[model samples]
Target: MMKNIILITLLAGFGFNLNAQPLAPDFTVTDSDGVEHQLYQDYLNQGKTVVIDLFFTYCPPCIALAPTLEDFYESWGGGTGDVEFIGLSIMNDDFNSDCAQFKIDHDVSYPMVGIDGGAIPAVQPYYSGDWGPFEGVPTFVVIHPDGTVDFDPSNGVYDGPGVTGLLEEAIRETGARKPYHLTGTVTMPGGNAIGSFDLNIEGELYSPGQMLPGGLFELDILLRPDSTYEISAVKSGSYNEGLTTFDMIKIRKHVLGIDNFQEPWKYLAADANSSGGISTADLIQLTKLVLAVSDNLPNNDPWGFIKTDYLFASPANPYEEAYQGDARTYMF
Candidate 1:
């Protein structure tokens, strides 16, 4: 057993990570849904930067990295077909079933599976160095279009700019785009922030981003010159009350990020300004409401968006008119 162990250790030294020279160790793994994915043929072959998340189910940091990785995936020229992402569970035990359950429970939209059933396990020991000191769960490594790997950010791997900064770095490094900067905000009607939610800059406008905590977003992409593009906000979260003094103060607090709000009001809703952001202006609008200087606050909404189901309701339906009797025209 000792001799066998020594031999394996010696063999691993001659493996994939022996100074990053070998072409990105190719592998084929099937997702729990039985969909086959190739590390090179499917991604690097199609001119897309391949990003793989090496993770495990039991790791907390790994779990925390899931959403951020998703956001990064979507923001980096996502819908424009510039990038692809996959998750590989590095669990060295029987975790195929756990991998499937982890995906469902976490609402993971990306492909995920354990390493043992695929070619990935072959290279794991080398890259992971026995899954020791350098084993970073949810380790995000990128494979460039030229069939090169971006394991170390410091090595000029990726350099694209804007949302998903690291990914843009990669895009820039690959010379994939000239890059146009698009920055904006997505807030509730009352000026209350949407917190964090996805925005799809479609018509292939390049990125699909989620709002920053301040309800702001920025996207830099290589769009067709003189061409128009469409942007859509992935309507998420609940619709709560956006009116009342409480709502106005909540908007103020949101803009301020004042967690220690004196009087500690319970918030149901806040964005009164329909500007897709919350700020002092929303507070002013609410002040107008309090003073009766204006009966209508711009947007008349403080919680969330009026989704298409309610926005594009039938005009011929009498109930539709009644439903919108108090609600103003849908805020964009």
Candidate 2:
């Protein structure tokens, strides 16, 4: 939803409608090391968020977003760190020496794939086979750690800040669950039961739903078993600006790449009203929390809001405050 409406003179075109799937389709892609990684198992399942930038080198916007994308990669690391950024040149002219030099000049630290063809499919298999001609450049997709495509490239991420905000939401969702067990039944369109159907929760697959002798049968799963919730909570009374209401406004500024701070986590942390985004309303609530007028935020006290990373690019963390940036300083 944080996408920009920019119809630039692109070298390529894309038209695809990707929705949130029960499980993100699988595909193998190799980075510079020639080590192929299964999009879901290798990264998403391992607690690494994914950002795939589909672009053409000739396009000015594509070239422009390159450095910002690199910053995003370093800001949130892959797997252990937080995010995995991949840049694919989806152009007709092969991504040869010229394209390679372009990346070098841009200082892109993430992996690049999809070269030598006007076609693309190996990356997002869900939309790979019969989706579209995909007539556009500088598009992107954000896959959550749970292997769900929160924002598919079909919708198109118009800019760096837009993509950055998407990544922050994915990271926040990762910290909300640690695989708690719950059960449910799968039914078909009619009154009949869809027995023995495999159940998927938070990306991971479960055994087929059991078929009982008499009437009702159910399946249970441990949700997000692989998720390591980095941001635990954004509570009140934290001296740290990143964790406190101070970062709330800072997050708004960062969404537009303003001020000295630029991060996806801040965007998620600033959404105090739980309205699905940070706005002036969240700032008002943050003001109350800071002034002791309120004890709880609408979206506060959850495991998802507590971002393990800090505002600045350094080792310093939050003080011993209940809802601060430093995960180490957490008491609750």
Candidate 3:
């Protein structure tokens, strides 16, 4: 009898001191119903406050905390409103059946995830101290929309409606707000749809240039409201893209001082070697690309985008100018 009691106590959770970081680690989990949830992408990035209950099935305190969480979950739109609730099992061996049984036993309506549902790895950062030390099971973590975490929202009170009020108060203290979205279209010259292009925001690679159906892109990721982002696009493939016999002839004429191009961008396009000016060397590279002798332009991308609002100090020689701003750029 004594041995069995000791085993049960060991199976429950061990106590730990609370010393967690303000920022929560992002994770992904699949619930018993097979619904996938990404901590940052799904909930926080969507401007939702998440209340996560980390517990095990056999624990008594965890059992006591379930009904209160259910009431709190329903009060906050039953996982459909600004607040989201997730029940995660800490036991590595607790599968979906164990979590489902726990949910049914307590009449819990929110998502309950177990090892089979990716709960263990999803909560590993908390217990592993990577995000900071955490308390024992039945711990409540309130994560605001901006990825801030309130590790002790319940403050040792987990049995009444007051606990729910505390959670709400913690959320408000974090000053959570909805996120803004950035949307735009990518196209080639003459308004033609680009096959694919890479997207960058604030010098970070956001998209790996996935193929868009009609070059329409929507960034619904974690974009903060009232924030400025330096967005840029890069599309480079097909060495002969926009290069032709006519281009070679034009460069030859410019080199010989026959017919000078008027636009600054035209000079930029003719600098195939990126040599800072138009010359016979550029005509040579353009000729190679047009004849399929080379598949890429040396020292220059096949296309580059410049903001339409850019100004050239030397209009006759636009290579002497440099402007940094928003614009759809491509190089031909």
Whose TM-score is greatest here? 3
Off by over 4 Å in 1: 1-20, 77-80, 119-133, 152-164, 176-332
Position 261, candidate 3: lDDT = 81
lDDT score, residue 29, model 2? 61
| Candidate 2, residue 68: lDDT | 71
**Which of candidates 2 and 3 reaches a greater TM-score?**
3
Instruction: Residues 1-332, candidate 1: write the lDDT tens digits.
Output: 00000000000000113244445777888777678887778877777767666667877766665565566556554425556667777667635677788877776667777754562573374374332234455455666777666563423212223224655465556545333565655544334454554444453223336656545566655643334444444443222323356655555666678742221112112334444344577577667766667666445322222322332233323233322341212221
Q: Where is model 3 more than 4 Å wrong at Cα?
A: 1-180, 202-204, 207-215, 224-228, 309-315, 320-332
- TM-score of each model, in listed order: 0.42, 0.42, 0.48
For each candidate, the alpha-carbon lDDT, in order, equals 0.50, 0.48, 0.66
Clashes of each: 19, 13, 7
Better of 1 and 2 by lDDT: 1
Error of 1 at 102 (Å): 2.0
Q: Which ten residues in a row have the lowest lDDT in candidate 3?
A: 1-10
By lDDT: ranked, best first: 3, 1, 2
